[model samples]
Target: MKDILMEIIESKRITLREQKKAVPAQLLENGASEERKMFSMRRALANSSTGIIAEFKRKSPSKGWINRDASPEEVTAAYQANGASALSILTDTPYFGGDLKDLRIARPEVNIPILRKDFIIDEYQLYQAKIIGADAVLLIAAALEKDECLQLAEKAHELGLEVLLEIHSEKELEYVDSAIDMVGVNNRNLGTFVTDVENSFRLASMLPKDMLLVSESGISSPETVKNLRQAGFRGFLIGENFMKTSNPGEALGSFIKQLN
Candidate 1:
């Protein structure tokens, strides 16, 4: 079977090289350093009745072009007004059909915490996230080594961005650390592109009980969110479920209604 994760990372490196030339690291850092207050995704989930981190995505490697014409500003604002605890913006262009402009545009549209969801493997991306006004970043355990993850997480902290460490299996659990503001269990296997919401249930017990647990991907119904909440999950990172619909915010609003 082809490894989709490896392919994305390779493409990401090539994209980064071009981006780095366009915007030097020091210039990116300077922009990120400008005074900006960050909303806490962890706290938002903790305090919300529906811990829905609504995502705005155009496409995916598993299911291409989910919503090619969705406007980041319109969808994200609707998400905030309709009852989302936070927002997640996909920033990977090659596979996800998104770029930094998605987050940059969506950032000012919503007051809720916005998580920059991408195949992040470099520290330079952290600055990119911060400069674009993202409050959090997704760090996939399968995409990075322990040392690399730690270094990137530390850099994220220095830039005042929270880190959501994503793990797919028991082995990847080792990447959990103090730097992580939230621990997310990815339901889809990056290597195979297969998804099962039960993956969250299977790993829920083994994850740190005190950590803010988040269930990511393959979550279509509110019933699953309720079950995961009972299993100690505080947040649910849902994208395709809502993005695939004609109106993502309305889809998210209807999903939240079921949760209540």
Candidate 2:
């Protein structure tokens, strides 16, 4: 592999600089200070019968465009109506074919917790998430230094946004702590973009017992979800499976029916 994860991060740094200069942190801060509607993804997953965190993503680094013309608002509303516990909206444009506007567009359509899924390397993104109506943000352990991850999580908290720390292997388990709202096991390797759902099962017993656990990527079967639930996972972040279909919401509804 070509270390694609670092490639994305490097591109992200450039994009961040341009974004900060164009929008200014103060503007984002002021907008974020204004109270916005909020929902608790952690609570939603904990109380739900089917813990499906449906994602609104247009593309991926490995698979390229999944659903190029999907509308954020329409798909998200359908996910909620179908039985999604929460929503994960990709806000990174270069690799994910998504932008902050997706969250802004999807926010008013659903009431569930909206997690801004991206390669977060700065607090400025946290302010942007809040201002645009995100309830939570994903912090990939592979994408940050130990201290950098903790600092970003802390800043997310200060802005009243929950942090879902994503880890790929057991070493990243050390990233888990009191500040994290949820711990997610990403089945996909960021470096190679390969997926293995077993990663979640492999790490299930090691994750913090009290913390909510989420299984991200490579999950398409209801049986796998059932097995993961038994393994201690409460939230399932599934994107490509649903997004690849023409009727994503309907696909999600069918998946939930199978799950039950």
- Model 1: per-residue Cα lDDT at residue 226: 92
Model 1 stretches astray by more than 4 angstroms? none
lDDT tens per residue, model 1, 105-179: 988788899999999988899999998999999999999999999999999999999999999999998899888
lDDT of each: 0.92, 0.94
Name the lDDT of candidate 1.
Answer: 0.92
> Ten residues in a row with the worst lDDT in model 2?
29-38
Estimated TM-score per prediction?
0.98, 0.99
Q: Candidate 1: how many backbone clashes?
A: 0
lDDT of 2 by residue, 1-260 (tens): 59999999999999999999999999988888888778999999999989999999999888899999999999999999999999999999989999999999999988899999999999999999999899999999999999999999999988899999999998998999898999999999999988999999999999879999999999999999999999999999999999999999999999999999
